[model samples]
Target chain A: MKYGYYPGCSLEYTAKPYDLSCREVFKALQIELEEIEDWNCCGATMYMSQDTLTAYSVSARNLSIAEHQGCGEVCAPCSSCYTILRKTNRYVKWDPHARAMINDALSAADLSYTGGLEVRHPLDILVNTIGLNRIVDRCVRSLEGYRIAPYYGCQIVRPVYHFDDMDNPTTMDRLFKALGAEVVEDYPGKVRCCGGMLMMTFEDVALDLNADLLEGAVTRGANCIATVCPMCQMNLESYQPQINAKRHSNYRVPIVYFTQLLGLALGIEPKKLGLDDLLRPLPKLAPAKPMEGVK
Target chain B: MGISQSVSPPLESELRSAFWDHVQMIPDGHKVKTCLQCGTCSGACPVSHAMDITPRGIVALFRAGMIEDILKSRTIWICASCYSCTVRCPAGIRVTDTLYALKRLAMEKKIYPDKFPVYALSKAFTRNIRKYGRNFELGLGFHYFLKTKPSKLMSNAKFGMGMMKRGRLATRPHKIKNLWEVRAIIERAEKIGGGK
Candidate 1:
């Protein structure tokens, strides 16, 4: 299956491993990811705070490019990018003024966004489109014994509610199980915010939020916290040390991209999936027997 | 700490029509004006304690025509935009977007809390996006630190070096190939009072 990919800014920087593993996993799954040419920033959460029209216009520019490339479905690895892209798509369709303003902006570059493009998260593509059965069929090295906490963060299932439950999403949980990993079914931080750009803006607030999320996973005895959002991984993983220092608690929960875990289950080398690039050291996992007759 | 209550409430004629006009401009902002003020937004907010006024109080301030007070306070700038308030609002008020509207208004009025690094970073981020068509992390960090928080720069030097060593942080901007197209869109949107 062919899809247009918008890696967003984080994929090129702080969340590069997510981009790397995402591409590798998709390639192994036989999905073609043709990148949208000349895509700009998705305006994230901050941009919209300043101007909705500009935010919508910028996000729509990406959609227009995806549509221009003749791709019906465009997927983003960053939850913020996916959320903003889809939010802009919906906004322009209803808000006439926003639509006109965006159209005016688009026309300057000879681009027009009719708002029909389907913006999806990589998790949505894997769980909904590719189907869990197909993912399980390709798992060669079962992640059987690893207990993983599935963290959806806030954006992916929220506001849009396209393919998963908004309050408590299970796409990542189910996907982890399919890959032969033990899913932490009641992971509380699943729908909580990872403090997002607040980490950069308001350090104390973001750190506090991160502490709660990390503590929730660690307390639940998760081997590692698996997430689909780059920001979540960055906040949860990078800030663990500071959070521990601040809260006077010792926790070493590794935050990994779900795609990276999927790559491992597919028998792809850990290095190839950028596993070593994580800020936190990968938690050692106990080897488990592959389920009999699985392959 | 009680900044919201310190200001003398505006007279009826002092109520700016522009505040309501701005609210009506966006669908979400319009919804916020219809808030029930049930305090769900305030309660749902994780960072409300850090704000000068709670989310529900901010909405109440808007409804009561306290634009000047809202602009002067740091509540809008302190919002994490987590959408927690937006998701939990029983009135289906897009509380988060309303907060965004308030931020936009604050930026336009140049009334954000002084010496707030978050506002500085937001400005730097936009400036980077405007110039490069994409965010230049190092450029943004430099711009932010240089402008608002130079003291924190030395502290972050090690982390910056680490990111640089790992090749995660780019030394230069990664401008899109068709940056002029992006520039055009930005300019056009700015002209329409959207990218102010």
Candidate 2:
């Protein structure tokens, strides 16, 4: 199957590993990813705060391009992008005022969105569309020793999206289990906020929020936290030293994109998956066991 | 002595009704009238402790016609936009969206907490998107620190350098080829009242 990919900004810079691993995993799974040409930012939460129509107009530009490309579905790796894009689609489809205004805005650029495109998160595509059994069938190694805390952060499953349970999402949990890893089911911070852009302007508050997420995972004996959002991975991973300094607690827990782990199970090399790009080093996992039916 | 009045007299009736009308204009803002005073929003908020006026308190203040006071509080900027409150609200109140509307109102009025630079970050982010069609992280940080707190640049230099060394920081901005298209969209949206 084929899909259009919107890496968003973070995936190009701070969350480059997420981009790398997601591409590598999809390739290994034989899913074609056709990138939308000349896509712009999704306007994230920042644009929405300043002007409603402008935010929708900006996000709709990408949808217009996707529809023009005949990409029936667009997959955004960043949770913020996924949420914003989907929100824009809903507004264009359901809100006539917004639809007319956005179309008017689009006309300035010679573009329009009639709303046939589906915006999806990579996690949903991997777990639901690809299915766990198919993923296991391709697995070459078992993640038996890794205790993973599946951190969903916010945005992806929120605002009442039916892709996963908004309150207690289990797609990542089940995906990890199917790969032979022990999932941390009691992780309370799974759907918690990772302080997002607040980490930049309000350091203290963001640090406290990240500290709680780290403490929750570490105290539960998790060696690493698996995440789907780029911002979550950046905040939870890169800010550990600061979190440790302020909280007076050492938190060496590695935060990684779930795709990196999935790639590893698929027998892709660590270098190919950008595992070396991680800010915190992952703990040594017990040697992989060969899949039961694999050579 | 007669019981002293603690609450201030409500705003002039005209101003009070105007403020209520503005609140109801937010997406699903009419739901504000249906708020149960349950405090579910505040309880679900991750950053509510840092907020001077909690989410639940914002709705209560709306009923009290104290939106001006709410605008001046740190609560609007402190919201991380996690949407926890929106998902968990039993009354189906879109709390986060309501806060976004308040932020827009505050921006329009040029009202914000004293010395707060949260708005600076958003300005820098949107500026970068407008210029490059995608966020230039390096440019965004430089602009943000300059506008908000120049001293932060020195302290954050180490972290910035680490990111650079890891190849996570792009030295050059990634500009889209069709820059005029994005500008046209923004310009047209602005001309059309920008959803006011």
Best-fitting candidate, measured by DockQ? 2
Write model 1 residue lDDT over A1-295, tens digit each, in one string. Answer: 4699999998998888888899999999999899998899988877887776777888899999998898978989898899899888887777777788789888988889887788888888998889988888877777876899999888887765588887788888778876777888988888888888777778888899999988888888788999888888878877777788899999888889999988888877888888877777676556645545443
Clashes of each: 0, 0
Residue-by-residue lDDT tens digits, candidate 2, B53-109 = 889998887777666777778889989989999988999888998888888777876
Native A-B contacts reproduced, model 1: 0.65
Lowest lDDT 10-mer window, candidate 2 chain A? A286-295
Which portions of model 1 show Cα errors greater than 4 Å?
A95-97, A284-295, B4-15, B194-196
Superposed Cα RMSD, model 2: 3.0
TM-score of chain A of 1: 0.95
Badly placed stretches (over 4 Å) of model 2 are: A293-295, B1-26
Cα shift from native, residue A116, model 2 (Å): 0.5
Error of 1 at A144 (Å): 1.9
